[model samples]
Target: MPRWIDTWMPGSGPEAPGGGYPGERLGLPAQGVSAVAGFGRRLAALTVDWLLGYGIAALFLGADVGTSPFAVLGVWFLLTAVPVAVFGSSAGMTALGIRVASVGSEPVVGVPRAVLRTALIALLVPPLVRDSDGRGWHDRAARTVVVRTRP
Candidate 1:
């Protein structure tokens, strides 16, 4: 009801002019392939990836999440970094039909950038902080954006 309400209430208040979908600035579609990935999907993908990392840690690294957090985190780091560097998507992201792309002109998220992104992700705070475009701080720092692969 108050004019200040819009500042704090997400997705509420009177419609602000020029408000467009996320990824509009990147020249992506509004609802189809290449559109900015929604938080739900991105979260789901992260869940899947985390579970996978946990499993890998348990089986190969002999690490339990409760007893050996660093092992699980290390696994997650590799799981996120290598594939993203090579394919533009991690295993979970691929399964969920989303991929990380460049906000800049770069064609792919290279190893160094992917490692940096994963490192920030390991810190866990960066991903929780999203921008107006719905990109996490890690993505912004790496000049990458997550986009949908399917409509």
Candidate 2:
């Protein structure tokens, strides 16, 4: 029996050959997360998005910006969503100190996934779309998770 396995697995010896808790590799934290924490972070992210969206809309309403209302909305969405997903933080996320990261072991993320995630997020309903993991469609589509920033 491997000593490390014994330490974490407890009752199961190394020769017991698995089937104890059934998740996580070793010392790493369990992949499963709390729904409440995720929801809170998402709410903060949404607040940031709201501010940006309304701010853009207001700007478009003004005579100074030549962009059409729809164009301004589009720009607002792009500006807000793209940077947030790829970098794991946007103006809102930055303010809230939360970041979006891939679910996989690697931290590298791409634009397409980010775009899809952002689009779903804009729907404003799908983020509430609960799955087995309690993640919304946006989170699932992006294959990303939101994490709080370190101080």
Candidate 3:
């Protein structure tokens, strides 16, 4: 793939007609390590993240965060962005056996992209919309994808 094309579209591409699996266009396996993560795993990972974020929010927000809400979201942003920038996986993603990786880069997304990705996820609309490859708009916008680390 050309660097310019990758620059423009990140993980977008055409694959063989019978590829028959998500992530095929991005040169990922159909199963096991580095395969595109399934929606159920992604949702479960997010549930864990949200619970953890709420726990941390309770520490500072003193019950008002349940009303304010954005504080919880803010904590979630930090929880996702910082670890994703440094380790390629948030705590929940790690626990769930997934990691976020840039489609055009080798291992991890940088801080700016991680922040953007987390912000889009916070919107609650982008993550619900997925492309053929199972990448949500948040992943697309960040030029990143979530892939399984284990089978």
Top candidate on TM-score is 3
Candidate 3 overall lDDT versus native: 0.86
Off by over 4 Å in 3: 1-19
TM-score per candidate, chains pooled? 0.84, 0.63, 0.86
Preferred candidate (TM-score higher): 1 or 2: 1
Report the lDDT of model 2 for residue 120.
79
Per-candidate clashes come to 0, 1, 0
> How does each model score on lDDT?
0.83, 0.60, 0.86
lDDT of 2 by residue, 77-134 (tens): 7876678656766787777666776677666457777788778777778787654333
Weakest 10 consecutive residues of candidate 3 by summed lDDT = 7-16
Prediction 3 TM-score vs. true? 0.86
lDDT string for model 1 (1-151, tens) is: 5775443233443443597877676678888889899999999998999999899888965634569888888888899899999899999999999999987788889999899888988888888887667777788778888999997
Which predicted model would earn the best lDDT?
A: 3
Alpha-carbon runs more than 4 Å astray in model 2:
1-37, 63-72, 132-134
Error in Å for residue 13 of model 2: 29
